[model samples]
Target: MEKSPTTHVEYDSSNAHSNGGDAITRVPTQGKDAVVGTVRLLLGNETVLLPTPSPDPKDPLNLPAWRKWSILILISVFGCSCVILASGLGPIFSVIRADYPGQELKANDLMVYPTLFMGIGNVLAMPITAVIGRRPIILLSMVTLVVSSIWCQHSGSLGSHIAGRNVMALAAGQSEALLPMMIQEIFFLHERGRKLAWFVFLENFLVGIFFFTSNYMVSAWGWRGWYAFFAAFNGLILLFSIFLLLETLFIRPDDASTGQVHLTLNDVGKVDEEGANELVFRVTTKDKDFLEPEKYGVRTWRTDLRLWRKIDNWAQVSYFYLDFLKGIVHPIFFWLLLLNGAYLGLYIYQASTFATILMSPPFSFKFNSLGYVQGAQILCCLVFLPLLGYAGDHLIRFLSKRNGGVYKPEYRLPSLALPAIAGVIGAFMYGQTAAHPEKYHWLGVALNYNIIFFAFLGANQVALTYAVDSFPLKAGPLLVVVCAGRGFISFGIGYAVLPSIQAIGYDGSMNVVGTICAVLAVAAIPMYYFGPTFRKLGQNYYGFGASKEHANGGSGH
Candidate 1:
């Protein structure tokens, strides 16, 4: 018997006199109405080959419980590779500055250029992924990244390296869109807050470790080693993906509308009393007009890799723009962006410049010595990672129980306030320290560094979970937006950091950055107070209401 979904079977015991006593068996799918096997097992009459599955989700072998952990472990590995890839390039910024020759270019611009391209890459990926798919997008992106890494290693001019970095952004940067998207696919309604925490930690904090390690590598093996190292690790990641990572692309979003049932009548199974031999009856549905599975993906030589090239221009014109418009209108989406930019952007902004800042006078730090300052972010992240992981989950679980097993996206926001407050304070302190490099400075600088990154770890975790909760089904596209925002904010800050520091002398400019952050944070209050309500209200208003409908049931939850 072929195994597929929505199948049924029946049992008939009508014939008995011709032979000895005969037994019958019947099995029905969850929604189907029919009998399966004998009502009583002890009678030794009927047995089911593959028992009918219950509608209530009770199959131990195929149940989500058994498979979820397996997927989580895999998702964690994939997510961590993004972490390693994302952070590993950081420490090499200075070496890159030395090797490349763009005279007028600021030292921090080395970090910023790639980040700027990374944001652009994110914008490009959303449409490409929607048209292609996640797996193909990931595979192609990895190859792009791998080639770019090699290009970077051998480049002569600053322009060549920048080109390579742009290619890297085109490929490797998709992880920003991919990680949370994958999480939505595998986890259940309740597991998102906790499951995505592992992902957020890997994406945000672990990158710091990679940054530190890259610095160490540069110290031992020189600047070229940074690219060599990136390529080597990237190759390993590709191998891990090829051998172990399953294809998560081309799979349709889980939706009830795409599922259906068919009706059929068939004979029941019978068992002979003489030797206990059993006969079975089955019914099947034949498809009349089978859909031509759309060929999706960029074409490649590998036969299996060849793509069906139909452009999804309508989806492109509609998806992100609608998402963008709705995002602007629905306070939740915008709020998520602000919190994301504020918290995640804070650490990214600070860390990218830390090396340049410390390497200069006052700190009087050397090449590799500047990396020691990264300890602040790594250590601070270690402290808060576990806290952020459980807090969102606990609050959601608590609210779900109170609401009679129902969960709301808004429930995830309470503990988030803690990090939000802590982050602003951290940024404020760091700005004050920079404002007066000559005065109340050393501890102020250290504390400023510590607090911003400290709050960053937690804020990032909560904010991402909230986004997933609010727009579970569209987690992919929404994440693309988040990635864009992060790339822009990070690149913008990193690009201008040295110049700003040089021109304004820390405090004056930091005060500016700090002020921008404070306003965004304050403006986000409505998102906190009225987020869930607004998500619902915008469903009918915007033509793209699928995201809103999912939040209640279909969305990532």
Candidate 2:
């Protein structure tokens, strides 16, 4: 028989906690009252905090809001800087090619190899981060970025330059995994969408702004100057990281006591009630903070800068590996990879080909003025950043409230609609403009560029945030799949774009590309509809822990 809403369970509290660190299961019982007890919400608290913070002041989740934001701001800026180094070369390829005269280096090689290596690097580095800690790996990557920048600046041949860029790209790749995990570890479930937006903005908007500004840098001091700038900037970030970045890998010993809950009602027995054959009651739990703050000593600045901490959970890594395997077959993972990959592929295709199209034949855009074309991207980013970041949070809060205070990850899916529409328009328009340059003005492609960037940035934020929200504990493995998948997917697209352009012409190619991406985007509708069922299928196996039944409870009221 299906358990009624009033189903109740009883357990021996002393026996349940006799062996510390194990969760107490509340078995359902038949009771007459329809009362359901849930995890204790702080009295009068409207929203339940997720992955509940411990009494320890040192827990990353317990840090002051200002401190958390400062760390996020610093890391995000450095991450965006790495992106600039990877992409800055896109607009200045001619200058780079000239340095290696008589070599058969193509623009696609410059674009493809680095992007491929970034993904490879991200996959390879994730397990190490899981075993070690985010601070050391992040700092190490920053140092490597600085060194690689110098190598690119001084390289004498095309091979050496490509090699340097690939190395730097490898360092940049770690951010894809680190950023989201760090945000998740430190911020509340309610705050993740907005915080992750910082990453998307830096990755998309700020990087787009760089495409415009980099041409001027190359014009004044040549291509080498661009590498020189990264070397200096990355060096500065490395110093700051050493002093400021705290280790976020902390273990919670009492997992069962934390706030996160999974509500499953199963009838184990029956009890008599007044005027009723049996009484059915439901088990409920509440998450609460430590009653006394002084019980845990405050964290010191010295402790904050520690490079490593002991993590006792050996099975955690194995669980991550399992999640990684499961994520490979997960429907949500595939949907996000396809949606994000398509936009990323399109963005890279546009960047790699922008110069070639405008600098040739009828349009003949001047070398000095070519960078301004990317200004369209900057404009689009500025307009959409607030919408995706703040407005997104507003929408989530409203939806969560409407859903009887239970927050579902699906609430975030509607935001995908705006980007999907923009992506279709951008892809087709850009393709048509490139194919028929004689008929359309350059402004047509510029508008397309603007819209496409908006789509890419929007997709990036939604895909990553949704993945993390779906499986917070498995963020390391889940991100490994998405980030690594995104990298390699973009690589394939980058390699194929030029040939596709030549073989089918831009119109035929883009029409196909746009249709495919729009379809991927449209798939979000069904995903939004069926997301919980899909999450429910994998949540238990993928390790959402005690709250596995509450797959949709990744957000707050």
lDDT by residue (tens digit), candidate 1, 270-307: 33332223323211122111211121122223422334
Name the lDDT of candidate 2: 0.69
| True-vs-predicted CA distance for residue 73, candidate 2, Å | 1.0
- TM-scores of all candidate predictions against the true structure: 0.72, 0.84
Error of 2 at 183 (Å): 1.3
Model 2, poorest ten-residue lDDT window?
13-22
CA shift of 375, model 1, Å = 4.1
Q: In each prediction, how many residue pairs overlap at the backbone (N, C-alpha, C within less than 3 A)?
A: 17, 21
Residue 156 alpha-carbon offset, candidate 1, angstroms: 0.7
Candidates in order: C-alpha RMSD to true structure: 11.5, 7.1
lDDT of each: 0.53, 0.69
**Any idea what lDDT model 1 has?**
0.53
**Against the true structure, whose TM-score is highest?**
2
Model 2 agreement with the true structure over 363-444: per-residue lDDT tens digits: 8988767778875566776667688887887787777776555467777888888987988998999999999999999876
